[model samples]
Target: MIQRLLIIFIYFTGVSNSTAGQGQATLVVTGSVHGQLDPCG
Candidate 1:
């Protein structure tokens, strides 16, 4: 869906920009999801 396309766009952009220059780069991913808890053991 929409999420998959967003992930691909971010990946390609990061790769292309890095190869074109030599400089420090930063990537930050932030989000908040509200849903039912799932047991993880």
Candidate 2:
């Protein structure tokens, strides 16, 4: 749903913004999300 779309969006942006020498960028996903996430903040 929303979460999957978010990840795909981030991935494309990261790929487009990667450096010449960098093969790919890494995203650090740090949080306490379990079941449903509250993104109203």
Candidate 3:
């Protein structure tokens, strides 16, 4: 039981970290596109 819990905890931590990084990357990409297209606005 303890091993299972540890595995789950590690899995979720990794997923969360990857997801956070992806979210940040997406935001940066979108922001760059927006800035280019709406430079005059």
Best model per TM-score: 3
Q: Root-mean-square deviation of each candidate, in angstroms?
A: 8.1, 6.1, 15.2
Candidate 3 lDDT at 32 equals 51
Across 1-41, the per-residue lDDT of candidate 3 in tens digits comes to 45654564565556557866666555654565565567583
Q: lDDT, candidate 3, residue 16?
A: 54
The estimated TM-scores of all candidates read 0.41, 0.40, 0.44
Off by over 4 Å in 2: 19-41
Clash statistics: count for each candidate: 0, 0, 0
What's the TM for model 2? Answer: 0.40
lDDT of each: 0.40, 0.49, 0.57
Give one digit per residue, the lDDT tens place, for model 1 in 1-41: 35754674576557657755322222222211111122330
Scanning candidate 1 in windows of ten residues, the lowest lDDT window is: 29-38
Q: Which is the leading candidate under lDDT?
A: 3
Q: Using lDDT as the measure, what is the rank order of every candidate, best first? A: 3, 2, 1
